[model samples]
Target: MNGGDGPSSYARNSAYQRGAIEAAGALLREEIHKRLDLANHTRSSFTIADFGCSSGPNTLLAIDIIIQALLHKFSSSTADVKTPEFQVFLNDLSHSDFNALFALLPPQSQRPYFVAGVPGSFYGNLFPKASLNLAHSSCALNWLSDLPPELTDTTSPAHNRGRIFYTGASAEVAQAYSCQFKKDIKSFLVARSRELAEDGLMALIVPGVPDGFLDSQASTGSEFDLVGSCCWAII
Candidate 1:
């Protein structure tokens, strides 16, 4: 699924969803503050960017929670400090409705100096190397461009019309899906690594199986396992 269609489709399909997305962002911001001591980094400015930031009520709601949490944390510190000026860059595909996102911004808040609608996939480089101090992505990375085509073959009795997991799929199809997923994930990590500063924090939340499963199958799963090992590799 493409970025525009993915979030819009999910927003339309889910009926019982509350403002849980925003709440999750708040929780993540709190975690990052505790981990990074953003308030103590007074000598230099800090920046953050959210990739695959789909435009809608949900996206802005999440950002608002994150910004508010950061502000609250920054305000509570007493140490002599050069208060870090924040640069929040909101990024999504070029086709996204950024006007709607801009209109939703709180009038009193300090707005982002750079508002960009980055075209193409976020699995590619989206920001400059060491440019970002904090990066956040949520519930978006799992949407691959399209399903792998190699798994589909008319002659094969197990083949099922471009799907990896049909009722009669062989082990090979499962392995192919796994391969595609790993490639996508590795691309994601490389792009993110270019954007993050040394000691920078990236809090990514995505739906997935356990990290141990990914680690155990390292030969077949090394690319996918990179997400869990980001801190170890970067730090």
Candidate 2:
């Protein structure tokens, strides 16, 4: 996520997706504003969580979209309202470059946000119940929180030997990946459900594979076919 500016450096290379991601976020702005309206929200403060927020400038586009939507709501309210202050949480794996992400953050004087990093797998709970007003994710959900355990167990009969993924593998291999994806997504949803406010809004963007490619039903695996081609490497 840091250091040299190359394909490996997410911060330096991720702008390729910024245009699309920001466009997607813009589409959600009106919807987010409506959600705030429906919630009858009048608070001058709010919290937002960005799950799997890898270190990059692209993440900020989505975060700001959500923040600006709420601010727009406050500005248009019939009653006098003060500008809202935002508390933003950027989440990713423990080894993620949180310092790099923080370094990119605007100074306190430039923005009305208090930013913090919450490092962990998104499949588990990261915040207290009802703590989040909005949750966002982009190009992250396609990855399982953990590798499909059955793929490594010989005795369990679901070993995914010789295949990186289940795309063209035996039915058992496909089933194993499917089952693992379902479990991961279920855990992720349950965790988020617990953490978000009742009226909270969530936005997620997933990159999808083309037709005929196999991936977790709950996920879109764009490079998944590569798994079948590179299957022998693992063996």
Predicted model with the maximum lDDT: 2
Candidate 2: RMSD over Cα atoms? 3.5
- Name model 2 segments beyond 4 Å from true: 1-7, 15-20, 79-81, 155-157, 209-235
- Write one digit per residue (lDDT tens) for candidate 2, span 1-235: 4533356798777764676687786678878766664335556668899998888877787787777787787777675566667899999999988877787778889876888899999999999999888888888887876777778887767787645666545677777777878898899899999998888888888766577654554242335555455655555
Give per-residue lDDT, candidate 1, residue 228: 35
lDDT of 1: 0.63
- The per-residue C-alpha lDDT of model 1 at residue 74 equals 68
Candidate 1 regions exceeding 4 Å error are 1-23, 39-44, 108-114, 153-158, 162-168, 209-235
lDDT per residue as tens, model 1, 1-235: 1223355553444332224465466567678568765543644667878777766546555555666666666676565565466677777777776766666566644553334455557888878898888887776776675677665666654355543242234666656666788999899888889888876788776755555453334342454344435745665
Tell me which residue pairs clash in candidate 2.
none
lDDT of each: 0.63, 0.77
